[model samples]
Target: MSGRRSPGDGGLYWDEKRGRWIASLTVGYTAGGRRIVKKASGKSKTEAKNKLKEIIRDYEDGLALTSSNETVAEAVRYWLEHGLKGRGDSTVILYTGFANNHVIPAIGARKLKDLSVEDIDRWLAGKARQLSTRSLKIIYSILNRSMRNAIVRDKVKRNIVALCEIPDGCEGRVSKALNLNQAETVLSSAEQADARIGGYIILSLMTGARTEELRKLSWSHVVAFDAEREVWLPVTETGWNHTDYAVYVWRSVRQGGDTKTAKSRRTLKLPQHAVEALRRLWEHEGLDKTDDCAGLGERLVFTTKNGTALSAGNVRRDFRKVIAKAGLTAAEWTPKELRTASCPCCRTPVSPSSRSHAWSATAIRRSPRPSTASRSTP
Candidate 1:
């Protein structure tokens, strides 16, 4: 026989061995005979009874458990593989990165039913102690969403992870950006390292172009009006530029997205120093490719020694070493930090213009705003 039914929800079941009341919600009408059962963890019957009531109410109202059969690991894989479809490539990559790096290692094997709110809270706390709060927040969100999917499908009684609190005061304040002296050191360092990297770094700092934008930059994107060049005057053309030569931000390559905002896609002008560096790079890489210029017009400015588009991972590793050798605190200074530290507003500004038909309209900005008060970690 069933225990008592509270108000509008399904009846409860009393487990003889466990000596507790479990929430049993059966849905699918008539001959279907499908049973959806949820349990509340408490020693006393009354305590479990009340919690069980809530689960039945939610279930009856159509919040059934969907992700019950799979382990947390299986659910996460499905979530990334299918749930995140139609999202940007970068989004998929980031989710995959976090699941593999943090979630799978910590709680992947645990059954969804075995995971408790307290267990999740403890995991998040540990992550907070080690990683940036931003990362933890992302993890929290992924778990919350993944479990929420389970709930709607009648797998779990509720999204237990939604109850977990995000760590407070864990994010470091924004402290990136280089002053003039530091900018010169970095630029000179890049110059001494390799003319190619030197020009790329200087252009990045000056134009505020994204690393990938520079990576995918082709000679076609840069239009020096022959008339303007002959006159030694600022060409009224714009591709992309920044107010700070040290801090450049353009588009995200991983996602193939444009600037994060309409304001971000505006054109920028380089300082005299940055232009000079670019001129040298153009002559070297440009000329080298011209003779064998098999793909001279492939449309990327920064390339590998073999003239293919640059990779972000390779650039970070190689550039960090170069920056360190150049006398910058390589550990604290990153390519991104260079852009943030330098004030591009100090450079010659460029005006924004629409790309012609020859240029593919692939410009779309990624969101610059980080997830601030989310329930998950990344």
Candidate 2:
């Protein structure tokens, strides 16, 4: 019986002692022994043959006998908590929000092995229905990153979400800025006011500086340049609000901090009008008696009555008030809109040069026969 090979049964035979047709396979060495494995049930011969064939094929393919069986939610959590542990706090918040609000609810229970490209597309479409395309894109990026981590661990074979596209209507909607007349009216209204809010409004409109950059402007980065000399800082140590005029470098806010992009970091010369507004703000704050006047290099350009940093929310609220007080429509006015919409003759975006009131140069140069320098707005 031991020497005889069974016909058409592969390695399967009837074990008389066990009273069953035992489907035996020769597995590789285990503990210095050639382990022969057998599986049997009181089933038909065909069923036995099929089951044995599957097990043998799987073994030959170098597949594990058991799976990690990591669920999507569980795997994503592990990936986030361990793999992305070193990411910034803001990034972590964004990823966590996307997972909690979008990914987990859709297909979180499925094992990582079971995720498919179709599953990702369906999930992305459903997310697009709820969130803006930009928000949906963020969620997709996080989930895709998580799945890629799973691939690295051999938990999944591919990243399905990478094949998906951001759905329609999920794009960045560009809000138009105010025209030149409206910008003039808004700036004029802010100028007549007795508070730093007016100056903040003017700065935003003139330089296209983001709200926080203006509010958090310090004296250290204030470069004083005249047409006579290239840019340089004055020796006098005065608070930014007290300085007559100064150049604002977008980078001076915080090196390697949150900003839109590298191109967003700009240097714009503040006009005399804006400089006067800053001086008045300085006198109003009574900084003459404070250490900040000596150019301590740390004072909020726009602050509350008590000299605390001005919140963007509060600035927007006050900006609307100033607009209304000036008999302007709040609907048509936003600080960002005011900055970018002022110059159509040049047909260029709001730039540091445009902010410096160099409209004529920018306008005349755009005669269709462009200079190489004219094409580069940076």
Candidate 3:
């Protein structure tokens, strides 16, 4: 009797160079009439044949096996190059930095198709010992997003990262608000600063506006009169004449130029300090030299000497200078922390009632001050 033959069984042979059993099969043919072969190798004939059977089953299920050799690093680079179109420059820089500094250096040489859940779990576990929870989350997101993109492009069949749990990492930095004394020192230092940065610091601290929003503030948004009431005011009015001065926080530096949230897009009544700072800025920059007080040319409030928008790095460097002059360690301060410092100066805590009429308090409190124990003389 002839030996029994199973349907779709491939030929098995010994591979002398690899010293292993090899199973080879003709799964299909290319459009050009070329044979498409699939092979599996193992220590024994039974192992090789079993792997071949699994590969044949996958082939019959209509899954493509073309990206078996793609590496994790290549996949990440592809995603970073193609997936982040139209993202803000800062965002792209940040994402790319994380991918190169963390993800690519760790397991980027692994084959994308061969990546396993255990491999991901072990990699994350190792990272947890050195990275912060926030950083780990970011890297995990990068890998997850890259793998998903690869799957869409048929570079890989599955995202092994999705099957792995993120291990707990180290604690991130804690954010703190400046006490009253610190706020006073910063404001005082700003008073003696250049008009551009001084105005930015005053407006940010007094109005509690975000640094991003301040970066996008335009000269047109600053109001100084009430057209309806036909009255000349020291500050700009928004919608009505309830306040002498105000600013429209309708935009930010984010992609699409929208505020961080709908609640962040309200009108802010300028405090006396902010109004004086803006007046000094206008005179110092000769902004009133133009006839269009409404700033029809779309002039940015804060910019470099060459009229270009200031980068975040430029603003941070300038802010650090001011902080250092204020007798504070520049390393511990950031431009965004000004908003936190302004919270205590609010007449009322941020609430729904305060948000509807004005986004922040009209006046900053100057009493109940704390001693300047931590302040240093510059």
RMSD values for the candidates in order, in angstroms, are 10.6, 8.3, 8.9
Q: Model 1: residues >4 Å from true position, as ranges?
A: 1-69, 169-174, 228-256, 286-298, 342-378
lDDT of 2: 0.61
Model 2, which residues run further than 4 Å from truth? 1-66, 188-196, 223-231, 234-244, 250-255, 258-266, 303-335, 343-378
lDDT of each: 0.60, 0.61, 0.75
Candidate 3: tens digits of C-alpha lDDT, residues 46-160: 8987988777777787766552688999999999999999888888999999999988988999989888888888889999999988888889999999999988887887777
| Highest-scoring model, TM-score | 3
Kindly state the number of residue pairs that clash in model 3: 5
Q: Lowest lDDT 10-mer window, candidate 2?
A: 359-368
- Model 1 C-alpha lDDT per residue in residues 191-283, reported as the tens digit of each score: 776777777777776555666567755553343323322311111122123222211233446454565555555334345566567657767
Lowest summed-lDDT stretch of 10 residues in model 1?
352-361
The CA lDDT at 133 in model 3 is 84
Cα shift from native, residue 25, model 3 (Å): 3.9
* Deviation in Å, model 1, residue 45 alpha carbon: 16
